[model samples]
Every structure is written in C-alpha cells, then in structure tokens.
Target: MGVIAMDKKQITLYYSSENSIGKQLNAYVESSGKDHLTIDISKTNVTGTQWAELADGLNKNISDLVNTDHPDFKEAYGENSVDLDDDGWLKILNKNPSLLKNAIVIKGKDFIELTSASDFKQYMDPDSAGIEKPY
Candidate 1:
C-alpha cells in the first residue's frame, strides 16, 4: 500500500505527552472546536519517515525538531552533541520521541511550531490574532 498522506483540511498536532508544552498545547487544540488530529508520540510509536515528513512540512531539518537543550538530550548526547546526518537525526527522533522541541500544529498548508498553548489560536482566527490594529 502507499503511504498515508496528511489531510489538508484537518488540523494535525504532533506532541509528546511527557512534555509540559505539549500538554499545554493539547488543551488549546482540544478546546478549539475544530476538526483536528492529535498524535501523542509518548504513547504511540512514530515512524522515522513520519518524523521526516513533519520536519519537512514544518520547513525545518530533523535536527531542528529536537530540543537539544532538553535535559534528556543533554544527558544522553552531552551538553554539546555532535552533528549527525539526516537519517541519523531521524533515527534519534523515532527512538526518542521525547526529544521533540515543541508541539507542531499543521492546518491545511499552514505549518506552525506552537511555541505556547495559545499559539495555535492565531490559526483559528488569523484576522484577530492579538493584533491591536493601531493603524
């Protein structure tokens, strides 16, 4: 069978339950009252190809998807970890899903790295995204 493609009309969330930011992001996503998909990498196993696709969709590299500053990453790879190739990075993510730096939200063609719980709110209503419209 062919690979399953992401639904352009659905909002997809990639997050780790073990991460606080991911947990917070979930709250916002769930309450949005919109069609969405939530993937908890903590309990589920995400494939290397899937992780790579997410990174690519987010306009980032595999390494960028990892929170290198996280304690777990630092403990396992050291304070200053060595660089690895694309495949190597994907392997790291597939094996250690907790290394995800932040919650990623994808709505249609829009891909956003949810920096905060409310970050996804902007996508819901782009016109009133905390802009004062002082002009």
Candidate 2:
C-alpha cells in the first residue's frame, strides 16, 4: 500500500505583549512542537465576527470570556450590578480589548482558552484530539 499522510490541523495562538502569562503560553506552544501562528490581540484589532466565531467554537458565553476583574469592567459595571447579555459583553471586549481573557488557542475547528499552562496537556492528549505531543 502507498504511504498515507493525514493533514495536520492548524493552530492559531492569540496572545498579548502586556501579559507575561500569554507570552509564556506562546513559548510553551512553540516548544511543544505544534505549528501555529501568533496574533497579538493587543496590537491587532479583532472584529466582532471573529470574537463571535471564537465564542461559538468554545461553546462559551461572552460573559465567560470577560475579565470581570479588569478596571474597565469594574468601572463600566459596578461589582453588584448584573444586567449584561452576551452581545453586551462582546461589545465591551471589542471596545476594550484589554478586558479580554488571555491565551486563546484556535486548533482546527476547536477553540480553547488556556487559563493555565497545564491546560495545554488536554490538547496534547490523543483521546482528546489525537494531537501530537512534544514529549
């Protein structure tokens, strides 16, 4: 039989220069031998459509993506107030990208947000996605 090659899934990492953790996550992904492109959301303007798509990929609500602790968030919505929908949160993120959560990974059709370094292991697991591991 002839040799067969499975197409590799594409990986895109969204990071920010201001966030040291995000920079570390980018390095970790690279060292893990995964092929990916890095986009600095702080530098690049992310469109609402892209944000919506990412939200869809992770099956995440926009409120889940918001950094509630961010100053912008606190200033806009006081600690006790709770009356914002997903679209409203998305709009806040679009206007204040700094209020966005960090280290978003887009692998093929899968969208993920890595809050910690260990989360990368989930993607490396074969049962999870049959993705290649660095070690």
Candidate 3:
C-alpha cells in the first residue's frame, strides 16, 4: 500500500467567533506560523463539496461535527434524538451551520476538533500526545 503524506501548508479552519474554543483556535492558528484559510460558518455558507471535505476529514464521523447541545438542535429533536447518519447530520448542518461544533482544524487530509483551549495545544504538539504525523 502507498502511504499518503500530509501537506501542512494546506490547512483550513472552520470556526465561530462566538464560541470561546473557536476564539482560542483562531488565535493559535494566527500565531502558529502556518498558512491557513479560516472560515466563520456563522457568517458564510459552506458548499456541498466543502461539507463533504470536512466530513471526510472527520473520517465521516458526523457526531463529532455537530453540537448536539445547541439549543436549536435540542429543542427540535430532544436530547436522545441525535442518532443521525452521515447524510442526516450533513443535511442539518447545511441548514443550520451555527449548530456545528466550535472549531475544526483541517491539516491536509486529516482534521481534529478544537473542543477546548487545551485541545489546541495537544493537537498542535502531537508528540506530547504520543501521536505521529499522519502520512
């Protein structure tokens, strides 16, 4: 099997300024000395292709991409009704991007969610987490 290498330069972030974790991620990326494209889903729309790319980066784990705790989601479906398949979650996110998780950091073909400020440091300095760069 051929191994795929990561292109660190091809980094993108989907984040919201309204969330603390997202705000911290934005600061980290700005100072991390890496080139990146930042998207605030609250103010802009993501195309279907872009959504697919984001989903792929998450290994198609739609639960990780969604904020089930968001009031809009909770009120509409109740707490236990989040058993959505990939397409179902994507459809919801397409209609309501604000319900997306705080921040998604896409580096090359891989991605990690910045759920907290500490997650930023852990993902950025992967060696400390006993993780090697995916290649």
Tell me each candidate's RMSD, in Å, in order.
4.3, 6.7, 4.1
lDDT (Cα, tens digit) per residue for candidate 2, span 1-135: 212111246577776656667777777777877676777777887766677776766788767777888776888888876678767877777677677775688765566788766677677666666654333
Note the residue pairs that clash in candidate 1: none
All models: lDDT?
Answer: 0.77, 0.69, 0.72
- Output the number of the lDDT-best candidate: 1
Off by over 4 Å in 2: 1-8, 85-87, 125-135
Ranking by TM-score: 1, 3, 2
Which should have the higher TM-score, number 1 or number 2? 1
Tens digits of per-residue lDDT for model 1, 1-135 = 213255666778989888788898888888878778898988877787777777787788888998888887888889876689988887777778888888888765556787777676665665865421222
**Which is the winner by lDDT between candidate 2 and candidate 3?**
3
lDDT of 3 by residue, 55-102 (tens): 666676666778888988898889786677767877887777767876
Question: What is residue 115's positional error in candidate 2, in angstroms?
Answer: 0.6
Q: Which residue pairs come into collision in candidate 3?
A: none
Please give the distance, in angstroms, between residue 51's alpha carbon in candidate 3 and its true position after superposition. 1.6
TM-score top scorer: 1
Q: Which residue pairs clash within candidate 2?
A: none
Error of 3 at 68 (Å): 1.7
Candidate 3 off by > 4 Å: 1-6, 80-88, 132-135
